[model samples]
Target: MMSNQNSVQSGFLPIPSIRRTVSPSQALSRSLATALVLALLIFVLGPLVVLVLWAFAGEWFYPSLIPQKFSLSWWSTVLSDSHFGHSVLLSFIFAPVVTILSACICLPAAYAFSRYQFPGRRAMFIGIFATNAFPKMGLYIAIAGILYATHLMDTFWGVIVIQLMNTVVVMTWIPAAAFSAVPKSLEEAARDVGAGPFRTFWHVTLPMARPGIIVAMIQAFLASFDEAQGTFLVGAPNYITMPVQMYSMVTNYPQQAAAVYSILLSMPSLILLLLIRKYIVGGYLAAGFRMK
Candidate 1:
């Protein structure tokens, strides 16, 4: 024992060195993963790269690696267009309104789903998401007749209500998970100090769940802003949002206008994503199921 202790003190302990070989299946999986990553990058980014090139191309024909010429003329033309400006204004106006209204309706419903065990709760939850399970275009076609009968077609509120359906499920579902992650102990602690139910929930539970709520609202805003089918079906030829404008430009073969509109439609959501990236980690989301 003394000699062993002396050997250990002298840093002479025998530690086995193990060299592991990669199995054939592991090697194949690694190769496939690399290929899949490269494929996905090209698939997603290829169109975006082409869009930027087309936006600046003065006159690039086929069979060319790069544009023959490039200019800022398209930018000037798109910026000066009054119709594009109107669509931009309408998108900015309605997306937030839809988000706010959705959030208001979702908040209480989310709380109930999170904290309660009422009858038909599971069915209602499943049914809410079932609306999103089907094809949205078919749903929009059905809703169009209702909008016409209700005299809501081609109106601002009509367009908003159409947009609202796209966001309602997402807003409620995300925030319900968020609210579920909040500790009941924290609410009880707040109440122990004399806070009422409303006060405790407002001061304690809400602040804890705020990050998720913000994320949900941002997603809701983006959904409403980018919803093409419903907005186009309900509000087109009268109230055109940015996504509908992009659709029209693409259909009309105005490549530069389409590219510029695409950029305008995408930039805000990208900026918001960058700003809230820290709150969007998988661990934060997984906390919904990690009940204390």
Candidate 2:
């Protein structure tokens, strides 16, 4: 009986040893994962962090691990400059207009694409996606010619129009996913409750799609705000944008220009992103849940 008990005890002893062995392996995996994530974060964000530091640094060129001094002189200089002020004002005005226009143009198309089985729908989507594959620079000549012909060249409207073309595709794709998440049964229930198409859309559909719409707006706004090539191509000489102004200043006043303009330009998108991050995450989760 003592031998039998000893055998059972010995068998149970390995269990703890097995657990101890597995724990290290699991810990190693978790450690590796954490290390990988940290590495990636540093890799991606290191440059931006450096840029921000450089912007604030009083003087930085070579052989400097850190700045000797820090001051707001750059900010003061850029803000006081008329050219920077004009460019910032122009960007602030143009970005929202482009976003709104893109949303207006895309919403209907997105609705049709998501809810209906129209002819050549997939093909049409493919075509739209193909546009992104092409180098946008290739189309600049054509765009410039059209803008010149329409007498919109070197105007704010020209930049808006150019941004609109790209924004619509993004805005539509985002909303279409949101729209598709709305159950057919819900629409039928609204109809059964004596709700017309517009009423159902306004009351039921729009609320559910709000997150996606916000995300689309954020995307469109960022696209419009950061647009350099198209704006430069179209609005050169006559109208100056923030990016254009930044480019011009880079040669003469790299530090001050990068410091002030980069912060100013990045602030809106960063604020917007922070504001809607939760909604964007929730929308994506809701989309996945609806799909299942």
Best by lDDT: 1
Error of 2 at 136 (Å): 1.6
Local error of candidate 2 at residue 194 (angstroms)? 1.3
What alpha-carbon RMSD in Å does predicted model 1 have with respect to the real structure? 6.3
lDDT, model 2, position 103? 81
What lDDT would candidate 2 get against the real structure? 0.79
Separate clash counts for every candidate = 0, 0
> Native-vs-model 1 lDDT?
0.83
lDDT of 2 by residue, 1-292 (tens): 9888766776889777577669999999999999999999999998788778877878776788777788777888778989887888888888888888888788888788788898989787666665566678777768899899999998878878887877866777778888887888898999999999999999998888778877888888888888888888998886677877778877778675676678787888889889988977776534522211
lDDT tens per residue, model 1, 10-46: 5643342111134666778999999999999999999
Please list all clashing residue pairs in model 2, or write none if there are none: none
TM-score leader = 2
